[model samples]
Target: MSRPESGAPTTTPPPTPPGESPAAPLPAAGPGPGAVAVPPSPCLSKVELRVSCRALLDRDALSKSDPCVMLLMQSRGQWVEVERTEVIKRNLHPVFSKVFTIDYYFEEVQKLRFEVFDINSSSVPCGPREDDFLGAAECTLGQIVSHKKITKPLVLKHGKHAGKSTITIIAEELSGNNNYVELFFSARKLDDKDLFSKSDPFLEIHKLDDDDTFQLVHRSEVIKNNLNPVWAPFTISINSLCSCNYDRLIKDQPGVALWDRGASLGRDVPHADEDLASGPVDGCG
Candidate 1:
């Protein structure tokens, strides 16, 4: 098992985030879920949101529509704007790279809204006359996280149709712990598991618990058609990784049989052609 490299220069974490300063203190979304706001005394979790649109209305007559998305949250009848996505030019189907992070609590219901717009100029315009409207969607933060992903049709101000436009939202929860570990790893000379293509491989980080059990802490994204894969570096909280115990056993193995490990990094599991072997511990040995 590898320990997080220590004493590396790092920026100090902020004391507490400067949350939105609403005009007036809004009440908690009770009885019903509401806005760029979310849940209570509440169990806490951080959620990362990603948005994509498909078959959107093309507002521009000269070319494909230039589209952007605005995220709003409802707080007990008040709507607060949370974040806005970058405008994608000349494309009807655009997968935005912007990520929205929000606090989640288990006690209360949380609401969310997405407003997609077609930008006509440098400055963003609003209202029906401005005619920049494309489509909008509303749902609860709980719903999106429960489904892990959701797709809903964009609607006009009052549930009116905005053509065939639709939006897809994906949600991922982050570890809530403070201490973290950063890892960078790669592998070479992996076995070829596919007949027509190169192997697709990734890595998994598992923590050995006090009960003599292993729990998965992290998994790298798959890199396809490559035997020599240099996976991207990732940061994981030490609490989730091993309860802040570096000496605790960690499994940083390639996706393969545990016996073969470092030498057999190939494909992921559940596939017909799974990884041929496993990988190394400690580091990129």
Candidate 2:
């Protein structure tokens, strides 16, 4: 037997030198269960909304068959439609754009559908068909719906509304089902300084569905001061319906009636001006 010379058994090794650090254990070859790869940087999912078109360049050039874009804001469980008027100038190359204001109260809604409608100022029967006006031609318009994630903590200091933060969003087109797009956004909070106590804060949402009629999908109210809240992504499944003859829906002796009613309900179609100029022309083929 070997002689027992040591004061203590030597199985344990000596302490590591102060200058050395234990090797960082090799990263696990694969992610372990329950460890979701730190959920993809929310920024990776940002999406941007782009609205563009042909007829939008000239209001006078508008016709019943001219293509126009419609955006339906669906959020807080309500759906509101916005009609865009095309803007055109004499010298510009038919650039189109429109601005929509949100006037609903809701929370946790962040997806929308952009519907492309072919409208003929002549077809709606609200105005005289002008022979000098450009005959019905097809036009294209597009809107982008994008979002950004709060990569770093967003500190919305009580009064700071102009601070910008970057985030990522995933985007999908309302008309295209298989296409999914990603985008990044540098977003700033809306300045509510002008908002009065009675004035509701408006946030726009896009709805995706074939039905002109929309049901309340969800309902929510703003919680005054919730911190570090993470919202799970939600999607409104679209049920595509056969294109219906929407012309019959508008029945009027003069186009003014629909406009008057719309104006009363604060639901006036911004593009109603086109109807006024187009006159009461028959849309039925």
Best by lDDT: 1
- The sequence of per-residue lDDT tens digits that candidate 2 reaches over residues 56-168 is 22224433334344455555766555454342222111212233333221223444434433344343455223321221211111222322111211122243221332111
Encode model 1's per-residue lDDT on 113-193: one tens digit a residue: 898887755444442234778888999999999997789999987779888889998776776557766777777777876
TM-score of 1: 0.49
**How accurate locally, in lDDT, is each candidate?**
0.67, 0.28
RMSD of 1: 20.2
Error of 2 at 184 (Å): 34
Off by over 4 Å in 1: 1-40, 125-130, 177-285
Residue 217 in candidate 2 has what lDDT? Answer: 22
* TM-score of every model versus the real structure: 0.49, 0.22
